[model samples]
Structures are given as structure tokens and as C-alpha cells.
Target: MALNVALLRASFEVVATANPRFVHRFYEVLFERYPQTRPMFPASGMARQEEMLTGALIAVLDHLEDAPWLTETLGALGAKHVGYGVTREMYDWVGASLLATLAEVAGSAWTPELNAAWTEAYGAIVSLMLARAAT
Candidate 1:
């Protein structure tokens, strides 16, 4: 499943300006929907965490065309996540929460086509992450 890079980038640009709030809403939705996952994050330094999340997303999106770098970087991230106790099943929860948050924040800019593209993109990301973790 190929991603609609243009749409993703454009929509992200719209959301990026409110990154702190966006990240806050993302975690709020994630924890509200799946309370069990809350312990995975620290109680403090959320600002830093938000920065990391947005930074990572931007890096991945920017390097989407660079397969080698993307794979290597995501692989390393996946391995690190494994150490942090992130399981394969959790990826689905994260993806759903992420999409929901994006839709809510994107407002009218959100469309079925954009949803499909993000779904595909997230799936691909999780697939790579899981594959790397398996080793």
C-alpha cells in the first residue's frame, strides 16, 4: 500500500503548527481509549516526549523515499521499543489512536482517501518495526 505523500505532508503541515496540543491530544486519546497503555509512558517530561514523537514522525516522513535509512532507523527504534516492553499487538492500538487523533485534529481536511493513505503508511511502519523486532 503506497502512501499519498502529498496529502500526508500537506495535512501534517496543517497539524504541525499545533504540535504540542496535537501530541497532547494524541496521548489523551490513546490513554482514554486504552488505559492499560498509560504506564508505558512516564508521568513527567511529556513536553520532551511530545517533541520526540513529532520529531520521529517528521524524520520518517522526510526519509520515506530513502528505504535504507528508513528501514535502519525504524529497525533501531523497534528494537528499542522491544526493550521498553512494546508488543506487536500494541501497534494496532497505537495506529488506531493515531488515526483518530489525526482525524479529530485535521477537522475538514480529513478524508477517506487521506485516512486510507495513513492507514497504509502506519501499517507499513508497524510491519517494518515488527519484522525488525522479530530478529
Candidate 2:
């Protein structure tokens, strides 16, 4: 399925503007819901991790239409993640946490359309990452 780029960008921008703690909220939800994943991250240096995630999200959104670049980048990223002990199942948990965080941040602005847009976008991203991780 195709991603709703416009909706994704607009909603992301709104969320970013509305919540300065976007990434923090994501980690909070993630750890709260999937405590098993908590050990994967360090207690300190989380600011750097959060920064990386924000950068990655921006890059993915910016290059959503660039399949070749997305594949190559995410492929390498996926392979790297494998080294970091990221299991394929963790992606689903992350996706759920991401959507939950976004919905929470977006508050009244969140809608069914935004949820579907992010769902499709995250699914595509994970599919690429997993495909390369399997290699």
C-alpha cells in the first residue's frame, strides 16, 4: 500500500510543534508497554539515541519517495540493528509505541487518517529493514 506522504508530513510537523518531548514520549511509551525492550537502551546517552531516532525519522520522511535510497539506507541500518540485538519482533513493538506516542502528542488533532498513514509508512519501513536484515 502507498503511504500518505502529505498527511504524514503534516501530522508529524504538527506533533513536533505541539510536543517538544516527542522522542522522549516515544521511549516512555515503549518502555512502559514493552519493559523487555528497556535493557536494549542505555540509562545514559539517551539524548543521543533520541537525536538519532529523530534524524532517522526526518531522513525517512524526506526520502519516502526515493526507493533506492531508502532501501540502501534502511538495509544497512537493519543490518546494523541486527548486530545491536534488535529482533524482528521488536519492530512491531516499536511501531505500536510510535503510533501511541504520536496519537498522544497529536491529541485532538489525531485522526484515523493519520493513524493509517503512519501505519502504512512504518510498515513499509520495517519491511525494508527486515528484508535487508535477513540477508
Candidate 3:
């Protein structure tokens, strides 16, 4: 099934509304799960980290209804990430991080429907971004 654009946006809006600590928790879980990403981000950052994550989240979610843009955007993101030294494994790790963060702050809103929606949304991104990174 196609992913739900509204739910995806709502989920992001929900997370963004949370205390800034949610951002900290997201990054902590993400980095702990994939220490490899530590090099992708600065060593000492909280605001910068939140800004990047929140912005990226908004960008990805906003384009959920546009497949061509999603592919192109993700591919570009993949190419840019090459400079950050991300790997195919790291792309997969990023997906894991995304899901983990959602689950962490999702509360009752993180239902099966939300889970499927984000998984598909993130998977579409990972597929293209990782493929571009591979080449």
C-alpha cells in the first residue's frame, strides 16, 4: 500500500512539538545504534543536531506525495552524504534510527498504522539514497 502523506506529516508535527529533549533522545539512540554515524555529525552539538534532524524530517515528510521528487531528493541526499562518509550499512542504520526515534516519542500515536506509514516512507528514502550512495 502507498504511504499516507497526512499521517506522515502529522507524525513529524507531533514529534517536532515535543520538548527539545526529544531531539536529544533521538540522536542519542541513533548514534548509540550506529556509532558509525558519529563521524557524519559534529562531536559537540545539540541545537545544530536538532536543526538538521528537524529540517530533514520536514523536507522528507513534505515531499511524501511526490514520488519523483522523493527519488531525486533522496538521491541527492545520498550523494551529499558521501562527503559525510556514510555507508550502505549506515543508510540501513539511518532507517533503524528513524523508526527508533518515532517509536520513542510516538506515545499512543505510534500505532500500527503509524508504524507502517513511517516504515514505508523511510524505506522509499533508504532505497534511493542507498542506491545512489552505492555508486
Model number with the top lDDT: 2
Off by over 4 Å in 2: none
Relative to the unseen true structure, what is the C-alpha lDDT of residue 49 in candidate 3, on a scale of 0 to 100? 70
Model 2, residue 62: distance off in Å is: 0.7
Cand. 2 TM to true fold? 0.96
Which model, 2 or 3, shows the larger TM-score?
2
TM-score of each: 0.93, 0.96, 0.83
Q: Please write out the lDDT profile of model 2 over residues 4-112, one tens digit for every residue.
A: 8888889999999999779999999999999999899998899999999999999999998889999999989998999989998899999999999999999999999
CA lDDT, every prediction? 0.85, 0.91, 0.76
For candidate 3, write residues 1-135 as lDDT tens digits.
278888888877787676445767777888898776677677777678788867776787777777788788788888888877776677667777778887778677778888888888777777878767864
Cα lDDT over the full model 3: 0.76
lDDT of 1 by residue, 1-135 (tens): 266788888878877664547978998999999999999899888888888998899998897787888788888899899998999889989999999999998888789988988899999888778767973
Looking at candidate 2, the ten consecutive residues that score lowest on lDDT are 1-10
Return the clash pairs for model 1, or none.
Answer: none
Model 1, position 29, has a per-residue lDDT of 93
Which prediction has more favorable lDDT, 2 or 3?
2
Model 1: how far residue 19 lies from native, Å: 5.6
